[model samples]
Target: MGVFTFTDEHTSSVPPVRLFKALIVDSHKLIPKLWPQAIKNIDILQGNGGPGTIKQINFVEGSQLGKMKNCVDELNEETFVYKHTMIDLKEKFEFIAYEVKFEPTPDEGSKNKMTSMYYTKGNVELKEEDIEAGKERALGMYKVAEAYLLQNPDAYA
Candidate 1:
Protein backbone atom coordinates (compact mmCIF):
# COMPACT_ATOMS: atom_id res chain seq x y z
CA MET A 1 0.00 0.00 0.00
CA GLY A 2 1.01 3.57 -0.64
CA VAL A 3 0.15 6.53 1.57
CA PHE A 4 -0.50 10.12 0.54
CA THR A 5 -0.94 12.92 3.02
CA PHE A 6 -2.72 16.24 2.75
CA THR A 7 -3.12 19.10 5.19
CA ASP A 8 -5.46 22.07 5.35
CA GLU A 9 -6.01 24.93 7.77
CA HIS A 10 -8.96 27.17 8.54
CA THR A 11 -9.38 30.11 10.86
CA SER A 12 -12.62 31.08 12.48
CA SER A 13 -13.95 33.88 14.63
CA VAL A 14 -15.36 31.31 17.02
CA PRO A 15 -13.39 30.08 20.02
CA PRO A 16 -11.45 26.88 19.90
CA VAL A 17 -13.32 25.11 22.66
CA ARG A 18 -16.66 26.05 21.19
CA LEU A 19 -15.68 24.97 17.70
CA PHE A 20 -14.25 21.78 19.08
CA LYS A 21 -17.41 21.00 20.97
CA ALA A 22 -19.62 21.61 17.96
CA LEU A 23 -17.40 19.83 15.43
CA ILE A 24 -16.03 16.92 17.42
CA VAL A 25 -18.17 16.39 20.50
CA ASP A 26 -21.53 16.95 18.83
CA SER A 27 -20.86 16.21 15.16
CA HIS A 28 -23.04 13.11 15.08
CA LYS A 29 -26.05 15.20 16.02
CA LEU A 30 -25.16 18.42 14.20
CA ILE A 31 -23.94 17.23 10.79
CA PRO A 32 -27.09 15.43 9.77
CA LYS A 33 -29.17 18.38 10.89
CA LEU A 34 -27.04 20.79 8.91
CA TRP A 35 -26.88 18.77 5.69
CA PRO A 36 -29.82 16.42 5.74
CA GLN A 37 -29.77 15.93 1.98
CA ALA A 38 -26.25 14.59 1.97
CA ILE A 39 -25.89 12.88 5.34
CA LYS A 40 -28.49 10.51 6.64
CA ASN A 41 -27.09 9.96 10.14
CA ILE A 42 -24.14 8.94 12.26
CA ASP A 43 -24.37 5.93 14.53
CA ILE A 44 -22.10 4.73 17.25
CA LEU A 45 -21.48 1.01 16.84
CA GLN A 46 -19.14 0.17 19.71
CA GLY A 47 -17.43 1.57 22.79
CA ASN A 48 -18.58 4.68 24.66
CA GLY A 49 -17.50 7.24 22.06
CA GLY A 50 -13.95 7.39 23.36
CA PRO A 51 -10.79 5.90 21.89
CA GLY A 52 -11.26 2.53 20.22
CA THR A 53 -14.87 3.36 19.49
CA ILE A 54 -16.41 2.43 16.13
CA LYS A 55 -18.79 4.73 14.32
CA GLN A 56 -20.74 4.50 11.09
CA ILE A 57 -21.70 7.46 8.93
CA ASN A 58 -24.59 6.82 6.61
CA PHE A 59 -24.99 9.01 3.57
CA VAL A 60 -28.19 9.80 1.80
CA GLU A 61 -29.31 7.78 -1.20
CA GLY A 62 -27.67 8.36 -4.61
CA SER A 63 -24.58 9.85 -3.03
CA GLN A 64 -21.16 9.13 -4.46
CA LEU A 65 -20.23 7.14 -1.39
CA GLY A 66 -22.82 5.18 0.48
CA LYS A 67 -21.35 4.95 3.99
CA MET A 68 -18.16 4.85 6.00
CA LYS A 69 -17.01 3.08 9.14
CA ASN A 70 -14.35 4.63 11.31
CA CYS A 71 -12.47 3.87 14.47
CA VAL A 72 -11.79 6.63 16.94
CA ASP A 73 -8.09 6.72 17.71
CA GLU A 74 -8.07 9.73 19.94
CA LEU A 75 -10.46 12.34 21.26
CA ASN A 76 -9.17 14.98 23.65
CA GLU A 77 -11.69 17.56 24.81
CA GLU A 78 -9.28 19.68 26.81
CA THR A 79 -6.71 19.82 24.04
CA PHE A 80 -9.26 20.02 21.25
CA VAL A 81 -7.76 17.26 19.13
CA TYR A 82 -9.46 14.35 17.39
CA LYS A 83 -8.10 11.48 15.31
CA HIS A 84 -9.82 8.67 13.47
CA THR A 85 -9.20 6.12 10.78
CA MET A 86 -11.65 4.96 8.12
CA ILE A 87 -11.49 1.19 7.97
CA ASP A 88 -14.09 0.31 5.35
CA LEU A 89 -12.86 1.91 2.13
CA LYS A 90 -11.85 -1.37 0.58
CA GLU A 91 -12.14 -0.48 -3.06
CA LYS A 92 -9.56 2.17 -3.94
CA PHE A 93 -8.06 2.69 -0.54
CA GLU A 94 -6.97 0.46 2.29
CA PHE A 95 -7.82 3.09 4.87
CA ILE A 96 -7.93 6.81 5.44
CA ALA A 97 -6.69 8.48 8.59
CA TYR A 98 -7.58 11.97 9.73
CA GLU A 99 -6.49 14.26 12.53
CA VAL A 100 -8.11 17.56 13.45
CA LYS A 101 -6.83 20.11 15.91
CA PHE A 102 -8.54 23.28 17.09
CA GLU A 103 -6.15 25.74 18.65
CA PRO A 104 -6.92 29.00 20.39
CA THR A 105 -5.62 32.11 18.70
CA PRO A 106 -4.31 35.28 20.31
CA ASP A 107 -7.55 37.07 19.53
CA GLU A 108 -9.59 34.36 21.27
CA GLY A 109 -10.64 32.98 17.92
CA SER A 110 -9.70 29.57 16.59
CA LYS A 111 -7.13 28.20 14.17
CA ASN A 112 -8.17 24.79 13.01
CA LYS A 113 -5.87 22.36 11.22
CA MET A 114 -6.73 19.10 9.51
CA THR A 115 -4.44 16.36 8.24
CA SER A 116 -5.53 13.45 6.11
CA MET A 117 -3.57 10.38 5.15
CA TYR A 118 -4.89 8.22 2.35
CA TYR A 119 -3.62 4.68 2.06
CA THR A 120 -4.07 3.27 -1.38
CA LYS A 121 -4.76 -0.40 -1.96
CA GLY A 122 -1.77 -1.00 -4.21
CA ASN A 123 0.90 1.14 -5.81
CA VAL A 124 -1.82 3.44 -7.09
CA GLU A 125 -0.92 7.10 -6.93
CA LEU A 126 -3.61 9.41 -5.61
CA LYS A 127 -3.80 12.90 -6.99
CA GLU A 128 -5.46 16.07 -5.74
CA GLU A 129 -8.31 15.77 -8.21
CA ASP A 130 -8.99 12.24 -7.06
CA ILE A 131 -9.76 13.46 -3.54
CA GLU A 132 -11.03 16.93 -4.28
CA ALA A 133 -14.63 16.08 -3.58
CA GLY A 134 -13.88 14.68 -0.15
CA LYS A 135 -11.70 17.67 0.65
CA GLU A 136 -14.44 20.08 -0.35
CA ARG A 137 -16.97 18.21 1.74
CA ALA A 138 -14.70 18.29 4.75
CA LEU A 139 -14.17 22.03 4.41
CA GLY A 140 -17.87 22.58 3.87
CA MET A 141 -18.65 20.68 7.04
CA TYR A 142 -16.25 22.83 9.05
CA LYS A 143 -17.72 26.01 7.61
CA VAL A 144 -21.21 24.86 8.46
CA ALA A 145 -20.25 24.18 12.03
CA GLU A 146 -18.48 27.52 12.25
CA ALA A 147 -21.51 29.31 10.93
CA TYR A 148 -23.79 27.49 13.34
CA LEU A 149 -21.65 28.51 16.30
CA LEU A 150 -21.36 32.07 15.07
CA GLN A 151 -25.09 32.32 14.73
CA ASN A 152 -25.63 30.93 18.22
CA PRO A 153 -23.07 32.49 20.53
CA ASP A 154 -24.37 30.67 23.59
CA ALA A 155 -24.09 27.27 21.94
CA TYR A 156 -21.23 24.97 22.98
CA ALA A 157 -19.94 27.68 25.29
Candidate 2:
Protein backbone atom coordinates (compact mmCIF):
# COMPACT_ATOMS: atom_id res chain seq x y z
CA MET A 1 0.00 0.00 0.00
CA GLY A 2 1.17 3.51 -0.74
CA VAL A 3 0.01 6.74 0.85
CA PHE A 4 0.03 10.00 -1.08
CA THR A 5 -0.84 13.26 0.65
CA PHE A 6 -1.77 16.73 -0.50
CA THR A 7 -2.68 19.96 1.26
CA ASP A 8 -4.61 23.04 0.22
CA GLU A 9 -5.84 26.24 1.82
CA HIS A 10 -8.67 28.70 1.19
CA THR A 11 -9.55 32.06 2.68
CA SER A 12 -13.09 33.19 3.26
CA SER A 13 -14.63 36.42 4.39
CA VAL A 14 -17.04 34.49 6.59
CA PRO A 15 -16.14 33.98 10.25
CA PRO A 16 -14.60 30.74 11.38
CA VAL A 17 -17.31 29.64 13.77
CA ARG A 18 -20.11 30.32 11.32
CA LEU A 19 -18.31 28.64 8.48
CA PHE A 20 -17.47 25.66 10.63
CA LYS A 21 -21.03 25.34 11.83
CA ALA A 22 -22.38 25.49 8.32
CA LEU A 23 -19.83 23.23 6.70
CA ILE A 24 -18.76 20.73 9.34
CA VAL A 25 -21.58 20.63 11.88
CA ASP A 26 -24.61 21.12 9.67
CA SER A 27 -23.31 19.77 6.39
CA HIS A 28 -25.82 16.95 6.33
CA LYS A 29 -28.67 19.41 6.12
CA LEU A 30 -26.93 22.13 4.18
CA ILE A 31 -25.15 20.42 1.31
CA PRO A 32 -28.16 18.96 -0.44
CA LYS A 33 -30.00 22.22 -0.06
CA LEU A 34 -27.11 24.10 -1.56
CA TRP A 35 -26.40 21.76 -4.43
CA PRO A 36 -29.31 19.47 -5.01
CA GLN A 37 -28.24 18.75 -8.56
CA ALA A 38 -25.05 17.11 -7.39
CA ILE A 39 -25.90 15.74 -3.95
CA LYS A 40 -29.09 14.10 -2.80
CA ASN A 41 -28.57 14.09 0.96
CA ILE A 42 -26.20 13.07 3.71
CA ASP A 43 -27.47 10.40 6.03
CA ILE A 44 -26.09 9.34 9.37
CA LEU A 45 -25.67 5.61 9.39
CA GLN A 46 -24.34 5.30 12.95
CA GLY A 47 -23.46 7.31 16.04
CA ASN A 48 -24.40 10.90 16.83
CA GLY A 49 -22.21 12.65 14.29
CA GLY A 50 -19.11 12.90 16.48
CA PRO A 51 -16.02 10.76 16.49
CA GLY A 52 -16.52 7.22 15.21
CA THR A 53 -19.72 8.13 13.43
CA ILE A 54 -20.51 6.76 10.01
CA LYS A 55 -22.15 8.88 7.33
CA GLN A 56 -23.26 8.19 3.82
CA ILE A 57 -23.26 10.79 1.11
CA ASN A 58 -25.81 9.95 -1.54
CA PHE A 59 -25.23 11.64 -4.82
CA VAL A 60 -27.99 12.63 -7.20
CA GLU A 61 -28.82 10.75 -10.34
CA GLY A 62 -26.66 11.38 -13.44
CA SER A 63 -23.64 12.05 -11.25
CA GLN A 64 -20.53 10.10 -12.10
CA LEU A 65 -20.02 8.83 -8.55
CA GLY A 66 -23.17 7.33 -7.16
CA LYS A 67 -22.51 7.33 -3.44
CA MET A 68 -19.82 7.00 -0.80
CA LYS A 69 -19.60 6.20 2.88
CA ASN A 70 -17.24 7.76 5.39
CA CYS A 71 -16.45 7.51 9.05
CA VAL A 72 -15.83 10.46 11.25
CA ASP A 73 -12.48 10.02 12.96
CA GLU A 74 -12.48 13.22 14.96
CA LEU A 75 -14.45 16.41 15.38
CA ASN A 76 -13.52 19.25 17.72
CA GLU A 77 -15.96 22.12 17.74
CA GLU A 78 -13.84 24.33 19.93
CA THR A 79 -10.79 23.96 17.73
CA PHE A 80 -12.74 23.88 14.47
CA VAL A 81 -11.05 20.69 13.30
CA TYR A 82 -12.64 17.69 11.57
CA LYS A 83 -11.13 14.46 10.34
CA HIS A 84 -12.79 11.66 8.42
CA THR A 85 -11.87 8.68 6.32
CA MET A 86 -13.75 7.22 3.41
CA ILE A 87 -14.76 3.71 4.36
CA ASP A 88 -15.79 2.81 0.82
CA LEU A 89 -13.13 2.96 -1.84
CA LYS A 90 -12.99 2.53 -5.58
CA GLU A 91 -11.04 -0.28 -7.21
CA LYS A 92 -7.72 1.55 -7.32
CA PHE A 93 -7.85 3.04 -3.83
CA GLU A 94 -7.54 1.52 -0.40
CA PHE A 95 -8.95 4.56 1.39
CA ILE A 96 -9.03 8.31 1.42
CA ALA A 97 -8.66 10.42 4.56
CA TYR A 98 -9.33 14.09 4.97
CA GLU A 99 -8.63 16.70 7.64
CA VAL A 100 -10.11 20.18 7.71
CA LYS A 101 -9.26 23.06 10.02
CA PHE A 102 -10.87 26.48 10.18
CA GLU A 103 -8.91 29.26 11.80
CA PRO A 104 -9.76 32.84 12.52
CA THR A 105 -7.99 35.53 10.53
CA PRO A 106 -7.07 39.01 11.72
CA ASP A 107 -9.70 40.53 9.46
CA GLU A 108 -12.47 38.66 11.27
CA GLY A 109 -12.55 36.19 8.42
CA SER A 110 -11.42 32.61 8.19
CA LYS A 111 -8.50 30.63 6.81
CA ASN A 112 -9.50 27.08 6.06
CA LYS A 113 -6.90 24.40 5.53
CA MET A 114 -7.57 20.95 4.13
CA THR A 115 -5.32 17.91 3.93
CA SER A 116 -6.05 14.79 1.92
CA MET A 117 -4.30 11.44 2.13
CA TYR A 118 -4.91 8.88 -0.55
CA TYR A 119 -4.09 5.28 0.25
CA THR A 120 -3.64 3.19 -2.85
CA LYS A 121 -3.67 -0.55 -3.32
CA GLY A 122 -0.22 -2.07 -3.78
CA ASN A 123 2.01 0.17 -5.87
CA VAL A 124 -0.77 2.06 -7.63
CA GLU A 125 0.06 5.71 -7.95
CA LEU A 126 -2.54 8.50 -8.17
CA LYS A 127 -2.38 11.20 -10.80
CA GLU A 128 -1.72 14.78 -9.68
CA GLU A 129 -4.59 16.01 -11.89
CA ASP A 130 -7.03 13.68 -10.21
CA ILE A 131 -6.06 14.92 -6.78
CA GLU A 132 -6.24 18.49 -7.95
CA ALA A 133 -9.71 17.94 -9.31
CA GLY A 134 -10.84 16.56 -5.98
CA LYS A 135 -9.33 19.53 -4.23
CA GLU A 136 -11.17 21.88 -6.52
CA ARG A 137 -14.47 20.18 -5.74
CA ALA A 138 -13.83 20.43 -2.03
CA LEU A 139 -12.98 24.09 -2.36
CA GLY A 140 -16.09 24.63 -4.43
CA MET A 141 -18.19 23.17 -1.65
CA TYR A 142 -16.49 25.44 0.88
CA LYS A 143 -17.11 28.46 -1.29
CA VAL A 144 -20.75 27.53 -1.70
CA ALA A 145 -21.19 27.37 2.05
CA GLU A 146 -19.23 30.57 2.48
CA ALA A 147 -21.41 32.34 -0.03
CA TYR A 148 -24.55 31.11 1.68
CA LEU A 149 -23.31 32.41 5.02
CA LEU A 150 -22.34 35.70 3.46
CA GLN A 151 -25.76 36.18 1.91
CA ASN A 152 -27.65 35.10 4.99
CA PRO A 153 -25.63 36.50 7.84
CA ASP A 154 -28.01 35.20 10.49
CA ALA A 155 -28.30 31.68 9.11
CA TYR A 156 -25.44 29.94 10.93
CA ALA A 157 -24.91 32.53 13.63
Model 1 RMSD in angstroms:
1.0
The residue-by-residue lDDT of candidate 1 on 1-157, one tens digit each, is 9988989998988999999888888888999998898889999999888999999999999987899898999999999999999897766899999999999999999899999999998878787787898789899888888888899999999
Tens-digit lDDT track of model 2 for 1-157: 9999888988988989999899999999998899887889999999998999999999899877788888999999999999999877888798899999999999999999999999999988798887977887788788788889999999989
Tell me the TM-score of each prediction against the true structure.
Answer: 0.96, 0.97
Which stretch of 10 consecutive residues in model 1 shows the poorest summed lDDT? 122-131
Local lDDT at 79 for model 2 = 97
Candidate 2 Cα errors over 4 Å, as ranges: none
Counted clashes in each candidate structure: 0, 0
Q: Cα RMSD (Å) between model 2 and the true structure?
A: 0.9
